[model samples]
Target: MEHGIVTFLTDYGIDGPALARAVEERGLDGLFLTEHTHIPTSRETPWPNGPDLPRHYSHTLDPFVALGAMAAVTERITLGTAVSLILQHNPIGLAKAVASVDHIAGGRVELGVGPGWNREEMANHGIDPRTRTARMLEHIAAMRAIWENDEAEFHGRFVDFDPIWSWPKPVRVPPVLIGGEGPTVLDRVLSHGDGWMPRRAGLDEIDALAARITELQTRAADAGRGHMLVTVFGVRPDAKELAAYADAGVDGVLFTLPAEGPDTVLPLLDEWAALVA
Candidate 1:
């Protein structure tokens, strides 16, 4: 079980470098940061998780910039974007940013991506919300091409770019984890993503979740690929819950940390460290 944690950091929270150092010292695998380029105020799309949108959604820091700062300060702990909204940014530029951070982190970066749920938020980036899934897949393919080939190009309905040279190529291509839940998510992960990152509640039906994972792993084996990683996000830091996940063959569980100052955040980190230990 690779134990990790993700924190939604506000401006007033412990800065990225300090947070990274604190986690690394505790021997945690990594620290993930969440992103929201900007949250539109129109409220055109209903909040997916609750009655109200959380304040962190509107004020979170740029994951790439924060990860870069974290990378400079910490050597062992990995850094990642828990779920970057791929549909909200130009894939070419986003690819560059990811590679740059991976380089800075010495190859310790996980690129977790999602087709965002907010219609108005997608519109802000000139993306049609309805076409987001298709666009997200193409964007990922285009980014992979950029990372793998010396001179890469991709032409697709949503993302089209000519052969071009981009540099400071990543020390290693970062693993792409697809984040979502539904009947089709596993198929998508098998097709492109290196792993699956489902929110905790998505796995509430344990029997079905286990069966799905088994089926997905079988599919991966048939396709001549290694087993797909099952990582559950926002897991409560409880022993029995974690043991259940481990028993279910989950590769990792990411605990959520409050976006607060070190005074509040550090104690939680200590608790998480002991939990994982």
Candidate 2:
């Protein structure tokens, strides 16, 4: 069994840095926040969580900005974008941001990203939502090239460029956590993601997802790569639920709170901390 409790995902606004610090002060090992460029005024896609997406998603701050502030304040805690909308980003610039944060954190960053849900948001970024999965894969590949090589070039359909140099690299390329749980998403996790995030589900789903990750790890090892991390998001603190996750091979479980300010955030940390201890 692992020794940590959970990571966090929030629509954190102004106080993102303080929220992360509070988590660390409470003895949590990692803190993360979600990213969305802008929430469309016209509601087309149903909110993944409930009847309607909360208003805070529309008012949130940029994830990298929050993570950078959090990194400066905390010593050993890992910081990450709970799920950065990958398809919305320019891969080269996005790669630079990831590397910069990794360097600032002294290598305590985890990357959790998704293909994205809003069609308008993707179109706005000049990315086609239809090919999001493919784009995400190539984006990861391109980033790895930049992170691992002194000068690298990518020529994929979605992300490509001439061999250009980028520097200060990263201490260790931050862990790439693919954020979604479908067959197509799983295949990508098996292929490129260093971890799988089974976000927002029942305890039953946790067990099954963990099994799938373990199975994928076996397959990956056979393929000569090690793709063995399973980081579940929005965990509830029932011992049975967590034990179930551990039995299923989960590396970590991150919880979701309705908000991230001290009011909603602090007490929950105290409550969740004792469970892991």
lDDT of all predictions: 0.86, 0.77
Could you tell me which residue pairs clash in candidate 1?
Answer: none
**Model 1: residues with Cα > 4 Å off, grouped in runs:** 202-204
Candidate 2's C-alpha runs over 4 A off are 1-14
Tell me how far the alpha carbon of residue 150 in candidate 1 is from the true structure, in angstroms, after superposition: 0.4
Clashing pairs in 2: 7-254
TM-score of each: 0.97, 0.92
TM-score of candidate 1 relative to the true fold: 0.97
Per-residue lDDT, model 1, residue 120, is: 85
Candidate 2, residues 1-277: lDDT per residue as tens digits? 4433333334452266677777788777788778888877876777766888777778777788778888898898778877888778887888898888888889998898888888877777787778988888888889889999998999988776999998769889988999887877768887788877767557767666766777888888888886467787778778888788778888887776555466765777788777777
In model 1, the worst 10-residue window by lDDT is 201-210
